[model samples]
Target chain A: MTAQIASSRVQRSSDMLAAPSLDSILALTAPGMECVNAVILTHMQSDIPLIPALAGHLISGGGKRMRPMLTVAGAELVGYAGEHQYKLAAAVEFIHTATLLHDDVVDGSDLRRGKAAANIIYGNPATVLVGDFLFSRAFQLMVGAQNLRVLDILATASAVIAEGEVDQLTAQRKVETTEAHYLDIIAAKTAALFAAACRVAAVVADRPAQEEQALDDYGRYLGVAFQLVDDAIDYDSEAAEMGKGKGDDFRDGKMTLPVILAYAAGDEEERQFWRDAIAGFLNSDEDLERAVTIIARHGTVAATRQRAEEYAQKAIAALSIFPPSPIRVAMEEAALFAVARRY
Target chain B: MTAQIASSRVQRSSDMLAAPSLDSILALTAPGMECVNAVILTHMQSDIPLIPALAGHLISGGGKRMRPMLTVAGAELVGYAGEHQYKLAAAVEFIHTATLLHDDVVDGSDLRRGKAAANIIYGNPATVLVGDFLFSRAFQLMVGAQNLRVLDILATASAVIAEGEVDQLTAQRKVETTEAHYLDIIAAKTAALFAAACRVAAVVADRPAQEEQALDDYGRYLGVAFQLVDDAIDYDSEAAEMGKGKGDDFRDGKMTLPVILAYAAGDEEERQFWRDAIAGFLNSDEDLERAVTIIARHGTVAATRQRAEEYAQKAIAALSIFPPSPIRVAMEEAALFAVARRY
Candidate 1:
């Protein structure tokens, strides 16, 4: 009971630092959640000297450890009080980190979260291998859970995420890339983990089937909204405003949401620029400026944000089946803030 | 029943091409095993135009698909009868391909199996992404198995393999790389999956615990033997006979098993050569030859082969626990041949 009170105090302190909606959900999470999270966080980092050097550069860069948080939070919501949540938390983080590592490699990204990308610092081989290491470790931890439902969810998500990445790779430059294709890829690659994270929480808690489906839906929509906003911010904000420093997605000729929308609205010349020059390389600062101008003209930036909002609203709607609780309320608001955040 | 007989016949035919002991186990696997092998053979080839062009050059150049073959053979030994075995066979191949992709990237090797590597042909980015794609696909197929044991084994193997690769990266030129260190790295990078493959076969069959453990032991020892032989072959075989291979480990200064063995043997001149030239770079053919002469004089090549043989023997011993079936017999022989094969 003393432990529970101490955890609550910690949660309250952390909640104060988060967004309003996040604060509420953060509060609702069980007192033991921190113990699980701490266990996961400690184990997730590599003990290998070089591995730690590279990972230190990453873990310090700071994305909201949201996926793992979801796992822990959902488990708590489902009434699970066991230590398995820690293992699940580590497992989820591993998968997430693996994807990020690969994404950097694929993009040849120089920076992530305002630091040098792993590939940039350690080279592609090390980055890729480390990513693989994280993936394998994640599985080891998940297996420790010894829950078929959790295993199935994670495995399926892992595969779908890869397929989604592949789809993005193939579809990135093509004008024929559709909304459906984008949604499909996002659902597989991004949302699947989010869905699985929440659903597994329910599995751990032994929650009712309907409640599990609701949480799964909530996570799926939340992931979609998060991605949509991510894509939107790339085009809408400048380096100074967005910590990303520069929008490389446009420069890289990626057919992100803004590009998709712009392509839909623009003329043959615009399409030709994308195909010949921008798609291949950004020739100069002028090319970037022109690309931005074209995206603005297409109303893609606003449209993308609106779509993100729709997804967030849908995420909130999914929580309707759950009985009213501070955590559920917080989840509803966090979905909105996820897209609304500056960075 | 007819399908099973047909598969057995096919296996027998393939086994006829190998050593006598391997032939018997080939006849014991279920009909679906062939289907799994087929999937592996088909998907293992890269479809990226340049990737395939390079892979075809390599595959046709005749590197044995030893890993995939081991996977299928292990499934047979365990009396696995499901269609999922075929998917697993493909999954194992994907994992193997991913490692090879990363290996080429790290080694910066132009040739593998005889032909140009994927990285050499398509560049590092393409190779890395394709490797990621294969890994994700492997995970996906494993998920379809809905077997937690299989997932756990494969996942853990993947992580260990990555760690081994990374360990090699740092320890490349260092003479301090001990036999234990070498074993640790290779066990994770190479043998873990081999063991996992056989163990998963037992898992799919829901075999007895002791039988499963035996199969896993066989795989672990077989993988160790196979890697030891491969490392030894780098020293003993002619470049031409070894398929576009060069004694590049010495030239590039990787502290492989033979080098470690020779270094530990305490030849002052050989140690100096390793420190000065092999640890740096072989400047000329003379340097390469000198290094080779030192290794030969140290009897390291013979010692390494002896170690490989010991592992193979141990692998054979592991199979004593299994029932006296033709499949089990073939499995035992295959483990021996894994070390004994010249190329």
Candidate 2:
């Protein structure tokens, strides 16, 4: 009976993925998102004008706000009716924005979300300082939530995310990086926050331990799927669709899942080609095209998509523990949408 | 009678400054220091070897650990005999170290504490991520301390410190920066944490509001005095004595109190010279020497020192509300020592 239910859900998810859109999922959390936005704008206020100015530049920029939406959606899934979820959702957004500001400086990129990166306009020092302010403000919001358990989860997630970023930094330009290593990196850098965002929803609702763990699993798998698709999009999508330039990961020599899979499956000559490419020997538009062709030849994009689909299935399975509801359906659809998006 | 006591304390502090050393203060906190060090080492552990390796490099890099010492000393002065102070002291050090890691990257600094900065060896992204890890670890420690008040104080201080750093960044190389602006920058960037570190001791000890406020004032004034002396030492001390380098503030075109005062006191031609020097027009050793000469000719170093002394006196006076004891005496001596140190 359990297997039958799981198989049916898997079939349904595949159908959902065929025409995936976040519209339904986003609509379910639209009210909570408005409250989250208000909280974000309110807490970002500072006596130092540069803080608000720099923060506003990015916050108002065209981010999908997917992480905060996940938080709100997760809260509703747990049947949480309290106001604390709004603050927690805003806190999640603040953490994401803070990391983005610092990430741009670390990457030394001049663009973010189709606009001039904050560091480019404000300078690295101001950008880094403002990032710190936002991070601290996120903590203040968590404290205001008046839940130590939530603080513990978010704080630990923050540390894990930082560790994952450092791990990725270590793995950069190294063609020897494995799929397992890539999974670990993504789990830490991306999935950890998603898991925490979902788990906090259960925390606020004072749900059973099983429910918390289930939502956490759902988010973790969904996040991994989302990042996998994002990495694949770097090689497969158009510049306009990606919201930043295409081939950014390739230009930066970042060793994402697609690159890792392609490198491992390639012949010796092809491996050397990847090595040189990542080592910056390859250049120009022709080289990028050739790199993409090589990736396609190995079927790594399809392999990467296959891996994302597996995680998406896991995300769907995790929700089976919860009873069926509109919120649950939207969340399950959101997981499918994560992997199905082209960009 | 109160006036007489204050005058006598002032006289004693002046005498103490003549032969100033932190030996007595450090000795008083020596046992607490050991526990704090242990906590720091334990919390810094990670499966990622790089996290500990980079953190250990800086943590063992021979900082005075003055901030942690202040925390331990504050707790001891409040007559708090508890284990929580050790964790709090370590948290204070972690916060300070985290800021330094990010600050080095922001400043593009090559050396810290007479060694190559972490960013030079580990890369900026690793340093930044590790700094984030340490900051989150600090919050985790605070949460373990189980005091909401302590969390509030430290979290708020973190935000203020970030704001101060941004204000300083905005003021950098601007000859028009005023003494008031300089004070505000230092107060937020440095003294806010100092005050929080001290105030948290009272919170943990469950001391009265008066004691909490008194210790906070003591830390705040001492921190201002310490930074003022540090800025003065940048122009007055030898490279060997200063650890990192002398004239770092000058080279960075930082608008310290001495620079602000000298610029304000200079004639039109001298003001243009100051402006040109700060704007990077002056680069040679002789130019630096001439800059020092002009500052001396205007007596700005002396003026800066006089201001530091005033704050140090205020720090000592703030301790009068606490009962006279060995701990109180050491704290008072520590404040005097802050301004008296040549480096």
i-RMSD of all predictions: 3.2, 0.8
Off by over 4 Å in 2: A1-15, A237-240, B1-15, B237-240
On TM-score, the candidate that comes out on top is 2
In the predicted model 2, the residue pairs found to clash are none
Interface RMSD of candidate 2? 0.8
Worst 10 residues of 2 chain A by lDDT: A1-10
Q: Once model 2 is optimally superposed onto the true structure by TM-score, how far is the C-alpha of residue B221 displaced, in angstroms? A: 0.7
**Which window of ten consecutive residues has the lowest lDDT sum in model 1 chain A?**
A237-246
- Ten residues in a row with the worst lDDT in model 1 chain B? B46-55
Which fraction of the native contacts appears in each prediction?
0.55, 0.72
Which candidate ranks first by DockQ, i.e. highest?
2
> What TM-scores do the predictions have?
0.85, 0.94
TM-score of chain A of 2: 0.94
